[model samples]
Structure formats: structure tokens, C-alpha cells
Target: MSDDEFTPRLGKSKGEDGKRLVKYGGRVLAAARLAGSKTGVLTRRFDGSRIGRGASIGRLLSSRDRLAGFRARRAIVKTRLVRMAGNGFAAARAHLRYIQRDGVTREGAPGALYGRETDLADGKEFLERCRDDRHQFRFIVSAEDGAEYPDLKPYIRRLMAQAEHDLGTRLDWVAVDHFNTDQPHTHVMLRGVDDRGKNLVIAREYIAHGFRERAAELATLDLGPRTDREIQQRLRRDVEQERLTAIDRRLLRRMDAARITSPAHNDPFQQAVATGRLRKLGAMGLAANLGAGRWRLADGLEDTLRRMGERGDIIRLMQRELTARRLERAPADRVIEGELNAPIIGRVIQRGFSDEHRDRHYLIVDGIDGRVHHLDIGRAAATEPTPEGAIVRIAPRSASARDVDRTIAEIARENGGRYSVALHLRHDPSASQAFAETHVRRLEAMRRAGAVERLSDGGWDIAADHVERAAAFETRQLRDRPVAIEMLSAAPLERLHGADAATWLDHAIASSEPLVLRDAGFGRDLRDALAARRQWLVEQELAEAEGGGVRMKRNAIALLQRRELLRVAGEIGSELGKDYVEAADGARIEGRLTRRLELTSGRHALVERSREFTLVPWRPVMERHVGKPVAGIMRSEGIHWQLGRGRGGPQIS
Candidate 1:
């Protein structure tokens, strides 16, 4: 049956929707029972009450047909297990014990015993291989009020009888359950497990054929006329169905190579950078130490680093004024040739800016500065755009993962649900649907045991005895307060890489005396140029519970590690390139994955199963172009610049 039909929802209290007076609610509860027993998404309104109804997204269920469904569930699932009896009687007993115990648990009862002792929880090693951590699964069945089915119960019995008689099995009961609501439903927790500890070996199509033979037998008894194929045909729910591309198909073949999203630890900075942090470094000029003694502007150094000081009036007079002033040049003048051009250079280049551009400065200094260092915004550090589906479906951040898990577990546990396992099926129906169904059952079991309280509105409230974080937000909020920043000293900033006592002083003084500070050029040295960074860090620290998160540009991070801040620093004395810091090093490097390449070491990478390439096409970074911008300004002819896959992409050509 299809599980996508909608049914009435009810409450459980007096005037409560679940009571007999509220027939619709009673039906909802019945359907909920079915939902609880199966792994289908149980979507509920996100609130704090039971007023909102919840159900499995896979299929709709109701009250009336639940028991009958249970009968079918019992019989069908039982038939599936009877085949195991051929191995021995222990297998038969194991199946029975598993079904009874598992069945009770599905109906909001405290569960004991992990399946049958003889059968492994998954039924067998091969089965375990096919399933995620938790083997509990519910077939997603969608049912609507108009959905018609012949009296298939008798046929189901016959199928069971045939299985019992043919297999010479001791177990004969049918398996089924019904949600006592309008969208009739049932969850079949079978009576037996295999000696090897598996459910059954029958393919869905094979079962359909057997049911057809039994249907003919039942027709003689005056049962309604419905084909087995009809029953099998009515099973689908909300989920994407697509013929994957050749690339995507190969990717699916290896989706399970990596486990679900959970790791003991990972670095955010490295993750951000490796994932291609951004298409641009943003408004603030990147403080790059080009491995040379100092940073070189794209035009090369017009003035020595020592000469560019805060103490210099000329330094503070014009450049910083334009930057800090944040002049909003008239759009008409975007292209320099007239008023848009600073009188100094008398020309403008139409360097396009991304939508998120902020604090733009578009003017270049002439011979006065020696090198033409055009002040601008947006450091284009681009990476290939992530595709829509799996290839780019990064595992949610750890924090996000923790939140989803905790929220789910908490709601379940509060209702006395025990989430022994959760498997990320990764675009699979079994994992997403049946997994959800079983989870609901566990939560209901907890509810039955008074472990949790289901709110009429939504969400859940746990008993005081079961005090624990049930959701990520709550869990995160519950951590004992972090060490306060007020207790820490402000000095030693010089010891810390980015923070210097001077930068803070400059920022504070700037706030107090902007004019005076600007004239004195007091904001000089490393602190002078990176005044914004210093301010940003201070603000960041103040906002966070602990000290702020410190980060450096990948290039700057590499340069800063050395005693000097220039391209020359990479020399034996400076040790720049030789001792360059990797992304995941203690020092944080934040930037996009501009491009990557493998050296010509002749070392072959591990061959991937994918038909098309998944591994990045890398060659050793052709002559590192750190301080110098490689992709120079391209004169664009048309409105849009087209780029191809390889480095030869038409980028504003």
C-alpha cells in the first residue's frame, strides 16, 4: 500500500485530541502507532505541544485497518522467517522470541532482549552487511481512504500455510499491526528470526507472485478480488527518484566508502579552506608576507615597508582616507577615464566586484609611491562551484550533525525511545524511511514507560529524572559557562601572532581621537596596516564566550610563521616555503581552494571506482604565485566572461 495519504490527527488528553470523544485524534494515535513501528519520517510541527500532528512521510495511516494490517504483518514477516527453520528449530524459536519482544517495543512498551539470542540482531553477517547499524526496518506503505485492496488476509494466511507446510515449519502465525486511525496501517514484527539471524531471503517480486497464487485460492472463499501486483504496486512515498548521470551513478557505488557524519574532532579553519573558503578574501586587504622580507604589491614595492608608516602624514593623508571613508563612487563613473579616476592617476579600471563587496577603494597611486598599488576590494580566490547533489553534499558540519542527532534522540528518549543506532543511508529509502519508523516506536516505548512527555503542541519535555540535552540547541546551551574573558589579561598580545599591544592601543585611541591619531600616524608598524584586523579580533573576542577565534589568510599564515614577512623569508634564514604551514596546522589558515595540483613525483594516486574523475586534477602549483596575482586582469569583450573546465576557462577574456 502507498504510505503518502493524509489522515486525521488527534490529541491524548481530555478535550485532548486522542481520547474517544475526539474520534479523529484517536485515529491519528492509531496511525502514529503504525508510524512509530516503521521507519518513515515523522514530521511534526516544530513547537512545544502535541496540538501538531506527526506522521511518517513515507505513508499515511489511520485507525481502522491497523489490526488487520498487523495480522498481515505477522503472517508475511513470519513466512519470510520460516525459511530459516530448514537450518534448525533454534532458528524457529529465535524468530518467535524476536517478533514478540520487538512487537511489544513497537507498541510503546518497555522492550527487553535484543532480538532472539540464537539469531544475531541482524539475522546474519550478510544481512548485516546490507543494513546500517540498526537492522530494524519497516516497509514504507502508503495508503489512502480510496485505496482498495481485496481481502488479502486469507491469501496471506495461505501463503504462510504454504510456507509452513512446504518448509515443514513450526511457526504459523501471520504478522501485522494497524494504526487505529483513518489511514489504515500495520507494522509486521514477525515471530521468528533465522538461526543465522536474518529476516528473510525472499525478493519483493517473488513474494508478489506467491501472494497471487494464494489470492486465487481465497477467491473461492468469497474474498474480494484484488491482485497481488496491486498491493505491491501501491508502495511509494515522498523521495527523489532520478536516473543518475554516469558520474553520479559511479559516485553512488562508493557512497558507503565513508561512514556517516560524525568525528571525534576536526578543524574548522582547515575544513573551511580545503572546502574552498570563499571566492574572494573580502574587503580588507590581505596582509600577505610573500616569503620575501616584506609583501609586494602586484606592481612590486614602490616604497620600502619602513617608509610606509603611520607616522607619515602622506600615508595617513590620502590612502587611508579613501579606504576608511568608503567612497561610494557614482555608478556612471565606475569606468575610470573621467571624474571617476583619481586626479593622481587620472584613469580607472573596471574591476568588477562581487555582490558581497564592502569597503571598496578603487584608485591607484602613481610614481609618487613608485609602484602602482591600486587600492581595491575582493581578493578573488575562486573554486569550482559545488554541484547540486551528492558530489557536493558535504557532511553537515559536526556541530550541525550533533544537533540533529541530539534533537532526534532527545525527543525519542523523552518519549522513552532508545536510539541504539542511527545510520546515514545516504539517499536510500530503507535508511531514511524504515529507520524513522523504528525510531518513532522507540520513542513511544519511552512514552509508555513514562520516560518522556509528548507535548500537544510539538517537541517534548523530559522528566527531571531523565535530565539530559535532547536537542543540539539545548545541549550547546547547557555546557557549563566557558572561562570568562574578563579574567584574562590583555597584555602579551605581542606574543600572540596577530594581536599586538600596539594595534589595540591604536584602535582604542582611534575611537577616542580619530583626527589626532590619524595625524600622528600612531597606527603604524604591523599594527598600523592591519588596524581593521585588530579591531575585528577585539570585537570577536568580546562577542564570544571565550577569546575570539583567530585566523589568518593561507598566504599570510605561511609568511607569518617565519621570522620575517616577505618573499625573502623563505630563504634558509627565513624558512618560508620549506616550512610552510599546512591548512590543518595549529595556525588557522582561512581561504578558498583556489586550485590544487600534484607534483611530478610520478606517484600514482589510488584509482577510484568512478567512471569520470572524482579526484582533483592537480599538478604541482606551477611556480607558486603567492605575493603576485596570477590571473591578471582580463580585458572582457562581452557582458559575461565564459570559462571552461580546465585552466583555459574563458575568464573575462
Candidate 2:
């Protein structure tokens, strides 16, 4: 690839002849997967030129006649490429792969550009030459970040111009207008022949191989006494040094003036809209707000606001909530006042929450004393308040229920029928029995081998032989299991006295379904993915390393699943674990532990890792819960969720 691949689009529209004018909107979508010919089963074509959407870009320019002639010339070149090669996706992929490998034409075909086709006769000859080519190649180059992101495009353009200058020819830009995804990528196409039908040769894998060195080389150079003031100077000098054309300068100026449109700092919509304003509208907002400050408010945003009576910057969220509604949800034709959420309650609504985050179903209460509180809707929905016995933990997914019941029963027996025993009334009786079986096997072996004795009341009376047997069993199991499987094998057990599965969770971080981050800009996709993964990590009680930044240890994950530990390495507070994982991708499926046993040292014996496909570093958490949350501890406010009329973030620890 010269510096990029050729991803050209051919379109046309009526020249404001106002009558059915059409023009080409250029660009194509491209994806590449090497070794595997098929992109995936969902893909429509094998050779790979599939245009899912055919809305042409030429329609806009048809409404403006001034740019017609220039567009026509470009359209002609595009048509020729379409005839000889494939559609945008295939051509773009081929071009990108070719450029990276340094595409160079040998004998046949007119070069990607055609200045020599001055006459109809020569153009016909040129088309013939292009059609006869036998070999095709690919190249790829990417700015590890993105071309449109902070200070990257200018650097890339310089590289392209250098390649063009070195080859003594203008590089054909084919993939510039690819429309679908905002990858900030491009493809340039070329042939061995130049405008004169002479031979052309270009380097291969040039982008990654060449630019890798180039980026480093540029990183050096003591631009001396660097400071914030010097940054602008360097940028200006770089643009000028590369001899940017007047058109390029105009584009950069327009981009520099663009504004963003969201609460998130790196909003993709802001970026996408800037591109549209640049390509279609010609200009955008003034410089975007980078510093911490207020957003110019829109209308109709007050419907969601309510005072939580906590202390933080959330007081200002009401204004933003109102503004967003006016911009996105309110009927555009109707002019409205402060949004529905903006109450007269003298506080700034600064907590930026979504409509869903704010849209909670209220309990619809009739309160005395003229006061109202939302109360936890989830808990209220599932639980009935009663003047009854206290709540306790249950472990049915574990085998401990049986052992626990036995312990309680024996205690009762020893007391000679004092108080009735009820250990977590809801856990299935079978699960409790299963838990006892696991412990019983080890105990029976020790007694039979003359190493220990079982008390008449079912307690262990052990000796050295019993200890020796446990040590042997644990060592054998560890040696047999691969490191990763052994790490993820045990499932965490949580004993919730009377609480159902749903009520015991940290509702903010735990959910049954997946979600997509929504945004008009492309970042919405990434944001959602990150949020879900982050939630999972948090629920697993896995926090990033503390001050020392230790690599999360594997053993900690096992301990958490075993429910023997709660808090991971550096986080505060221990917690009960409710975790489950497959031993390997194709290994035996993991069923809920209807038969339970305490997950402790020497357990996890049944998890099997296949002889092949070694498990890599699997995702797991290390949590050690000493006991449930201390009463009155402020709830976590990290998650933005709704409970009745209220919306709040989990309080930070």
C-alpha cells in the first residue's frame, strides 16, 4: 500500500437541473481476515463485493451545479475501477493488503490514475490494458489510534505525500469515502503503469514496516524546550513543512473549530457530526469545550429531576438532563420551557443520566405525614414484610447445606430437643444432603484406615493419617489440572438467609442481559462493551491493583469461587462469591450444584480440562467476603440506575 488503500465510490446526481439530478456519494466498507477466506457465515458473498446499502452520495451535489464537472471526471475513473475489479469492500481490502505489501505494477494495466488518456482512442487502449492484468496484491497501514483523533491525520498525510514524491507519481486515493463505520481508515489503489502507460513499482507492507520506523524517528528530534505554548507552534510548522495544500489547510481549520455533543468527554457523535459538517455543511461549532465547564442548555429537560439530598456535583445534572431532552426527545416544532425534570428545588442537576436511568416505575404510594421515599423497588417487589423470624444465609449450590444442617441437628440432639432447627428454610433438602456426602467420603476413609475415629454424634476425631490423606488428595488434584482450569473451576457460593437469587445481588453491577452503548456516533458500541465488562469485573470483586499494582493472582480467583474468600487482593471488605465458569470451551457443561459440598481446600476435584486446547488466563474474580455489608454503610453510587422516582450512582467506596 502506498500509505493507504484505494476505496473509491462512483455516484452522480442531476446538476441542480433540479430535475432528477443524481451524483455519486463515494466510500465503501472494508474488513479483512487473512488465511480464512470466508469473513464469516453471516457474510453474503464469497469473493466479497457486497453492497448492503445502495443509497448514492451523488444526489447532494446534483443540487449544486458548480461542482459537477469535477465530480464527473472523478466518477469516470471510479466506473473504470468497478468494471475491472470488484465492489468497494473487496477492492478496499485488496488495496489495503497490497499497499502494506508495497504494491507495484509490473507490465500490464494503466496505472490507477489516467492523465495520458487525453483522447478517446488512448482511453480505449488504457481500458484494455487494465482489463488484462493477472496478479492482485494488498497492503495495510493504520495509525494505532485513529487518523481523526488528536494530531494523527497530518502525520499520516506527510507519509502519503512522501511515498508519492518518491515514486514520482500521484498516488490514487480509492477508499477515502468509506461510509459505514467510523474507523478513520483509507485505501489507495495503483498499478504498475503511470499515466504514460509506463512501468510502476511500489514497496510492500510499507505502512506498518515503514511507518513503524517513521513514527519513532519523528518521536525523537529535540524540538527543544517543549511546553504547552510550543505545541501549537510545532503543529503549525509541521503542516507548513509538509506543504499542505490550501484545500487541506481549509479542512484542518474547519475541524479545529468543531464542537462535541455529549456529557462523555470523548463522544463519538461529536466526531461523526464534525465529519458531516466538514463534508456536507462546510463548517461546525466553535472550539469544543475541553475544560470542565457548563454546556449551553437546550429546552425541555426537567421531567427527570429529583433531589437525593446527598452532597456532590450532581446538583447540576438537572440542567443537562433538561437540555438533552429538548435536543433529542421533545417535539421539535414545539418550543418548551425548562425541561420537565427541572424542579424549583434550588439545586443544579449535574448528574448526567439517561432517560432509562431516570425512568423508574414508582410504587405509587399514599403516605401519611406528607412525605415520600422510593424505597428499593426490586426488594419491595419480591419480598413481603412480616413480623416473623430473622433472615439467614443458605448454600444450595454448595454441598455445605447438608453438613450445616447436620451440625445444627447434632447441636439440637446434644441439647436434648430444645429449639427447632431450620437452616435456610427454602434450600432444597436434597442439596443439603449432597453437601454432607462430599465431606462424608473423606471422613469415612480416615476412620476405616485406622487414622481417626468418628464421634458417635458425627464429629471428626482425626489423627496424622487423616491429615496425610487430605494432603495426598489435594496434591494429586492440583497436579492433574491445568493452571487456568484449576483457577476458574470452583463456583462461588453465597448463603442468603431467606433472600431469593435476585434480591441478594448488588443490583447496580449485576444484570441478566447484555446491553449496547447507544450513541449517534460510533463510540456508543465501544462504550456499551466496556460498561458490561466493567460491571462483570466489579461483581466478581476484582479491582485493579492498588498502589503497588500487583498482577491479579490466579489463586485468589479460586478462593472467591470457593466462597472461602470475598475481597480480592487490595480492595476493602470481604464478600460471598456467586460465581460459575466452564473448565474449558468444549469440556463438560457445568450444572448448578443441586448436590452441594463446602468449596474448600482439596475440593474442585470434578472439574476436568481436556488434553488439548490449554486454558489461557480466564476471566475470574478474587473476592473474600467476611460478612454482609455493615449496617448504614453508604451504598455504592458507581452505577446510575433508577429506583421508583429516584436515580443515583452507586456511592464510591
Model 1, span 161-188: residue lDDT tens: 5544433333313333233223333223
Q: Which regions of candidate 1 fall more than 4 Å away from where they truly are?
A: 1-159, 165-208, 212-653
Q: Give each prediction's root-mean-square deviation over alpha carbons.
A: 34.6, 30.4
Error of 2 at 536 (Å): 42
lDDT of 2: 0.28
Question: Please, what are the lDDT tens digits per residue for candidate 2 over residues 542-592?
Answer: 534345322233443444443432212112111122233324322333222
TM-score of each: 0.17, 0.17
lDDT of each: 0.29, 0.28
Task: State which candidate has the highest lDDT.
Answer: 1
RMSD of 2: 30.4
